[model samples]
Target chain A: MPEVADPEPLPVPLARAGDPAAWDALFRRYQLPLYVFVFELVRDESASLDLVQETFLAAVKHLGTLRDNAKFGSWLFGIAHQKCRQRWRQRTEVLFDEIPESAGEWEPGPDDLLIRREEEAGFMNLVAQLPPPQRAALLLHYVEEFSLEEIARITEAQLGTVKSRLHYAKRALRKLLEAKNENPA
Target chain B: MKTPRELLLARHRAAEPKLDALRREVVAAELNNQATREQSFKVSLVTSLLCCSNKLWRELVWPCRRTWAALAAVWVVLALVHLAQRDGSPPALAQSAPTAGMILTFRDQQEILNELFADRSVPAEVVRPGIYAPKPRTETVALLAA
Candidate 1:
């Protein structure tokens, strides 16, 4: 990515050397986008936060394993993606939704709560309806704006596979939206 | 109605403003815990080696530390066992080993022949031919003097 998103990106060396500020800076740079991507997959904000924490911890721990420091964003996303896959494979008996909710640090307040809730619910419902892999590709591409190569790396799929996933996802979403218009849900 | 792509982008963009607070928290939490979570000794060694020119060597010896540790443990156990076995056993006897020599046994030739031929008709004793036998120490000294 261009330096525009991060004017002074944390050096990979400093992070690899276990520099606290570097790790903090790295976490700050990617946490929101990564959380949104994970929350989209798991459909639980709490679990999304856990997965984000897990991803950053893992990235910080295994920073040396990363080949290109510049692609840290994609690599970190890949770790989060793996965590989501693991959560899917080993689901606990308790419904994540049934769990008591914690007070999040950020509340929408009286102003944005109702509108944000509706938009978030609507967008999430649409995205969730797509096949998991396709939805992941779409989110990584459109929402996070990862390059095609980066998405392919994060998804651990062939470049062509990434393209096809995005292709099928957009087509499926468009079709669903058209049907929704016809039915006026 | 807006297109689906537009809706996705719009939602993503709007969501971030609210999430920035949570992101800040995540950063703070990670930074606070950083000191306690340095890479382990083995991992740090592997990490250093991996950053070297022989990165391929790093893969080959990825489990080197653990393997070396196991081997050292086994060696120490074996050394301890050997020491215990040595201490537990009695010391070797101080007596000397038997000497080498030749001796002869003279028997009745006719009786010997009859016994060889009577194997089927009667139970015959089997005898082994030997020249040397261990004698008492006194006899040994007397024979040596002779």
Candidate 2:
């Protein structure tokens, strides 16, 4: 039998300090994840895009100051979190009635797209109803796949505070989802 | 009951924004916008250099009060010199005046001889021939002609 070589791992995408192309490459690699993260945080497409753009612009400007290039994902999300906080502070109401109709319109691949979308939408709606800290914690913990420590770093909260928020957020979200399911709204 | 956190994140990844088209459009537009802004900034800078206010130019060119004062003094001196020459008047003060020896020797020879006699201790060296002979008039006439 012929020996098979293991495939080379794809290089982790990292923006060179101040290189726009590198920033763009990083943007391309993480845009979707960051966008979804922003969308989940802000719950509006236009605001999410604006926040993402601001985050990227801020990142590009301050890229040289970043100590670790490998942690670009968490760094970007941290910027996104700051932007979200600023926006939330400026506007008393974070929830928008105008959810993107196109969000529901996106077709899923071979995976159960509709079911996942429904679940996501339901989860977001439930999350939206929670207090801001809890919501942020839940979104960072679950949707963004940030570890508890990463969530703390992103949110600028202590580890215990983040854990508390997550605990309460999960309990709140479960109650909301269960209530919705029972009512069949 | 299934935890909402696990279920939400799993579904969230499924709906993640695919970056193919959006990335290209956003990045291209951003880069183009930056280039345009830089070009506009350069144009504005050049325009300001060429057509900036006279006060601004004065401030830039002179930069300091001492320099401006020096420049003013030079200009005033030049202007006075020019006016004097234009009006055909002699300079107020000649920079090179005749020395005392030239004037006294020419105008008051008796007094000069008296002063020399009072100060002198005569020696054999005073008897050197042609020590005080008048120069030949040829060189004098040539210089006067020039």
TM-score of chain B of 2: 0.30
Against the true structure, candidate 2 reaches a TM-score of: 0.50
Model 2 RMSD in angstroms:
19.3
Cα deviation at B76, candidate 1, in Å, is 36
lDDT of 1 by residue, B37-99 (tens): 554666778877778747655665665978878988999999998899788756455344433
For residues A55-144, what per-residue lDDT tens digits would candidate 1 score against the true structure? Answer: 876876687789888888888899998888789768853322232323222111221111133344555676887667777887887555
lDDT of 1 at B76: 100
Q: RMSD to native for every prediction?
A: 21.4, 19.3
TM-score of each prediction? 0.50, 0.50
- Which digits, one per residue and each the tens of the lDDT, describe model 2 over residues A1-185? 01112143212333442345765667766676677667766688778777877787776667666677666677888998888888976887554212221111112123111223345566656767767777776666555556788888888876766776766766555576566667864
RMSD of 1: 21.4
Error of 1 at B97 (Å): 55
Candidate models: Cα lDDT each: 0.67, 0.64
Per-residue alpha-carbon lDDT of candidate 2 for residues B1-146, written as tens digits (9 for 90 to 100): 33444454444454345444456566676677668888999999988877777667677765787887899999999999898797995665775788889887777887777788895566767766665657789978998999
Candidate with top DockQ is 2
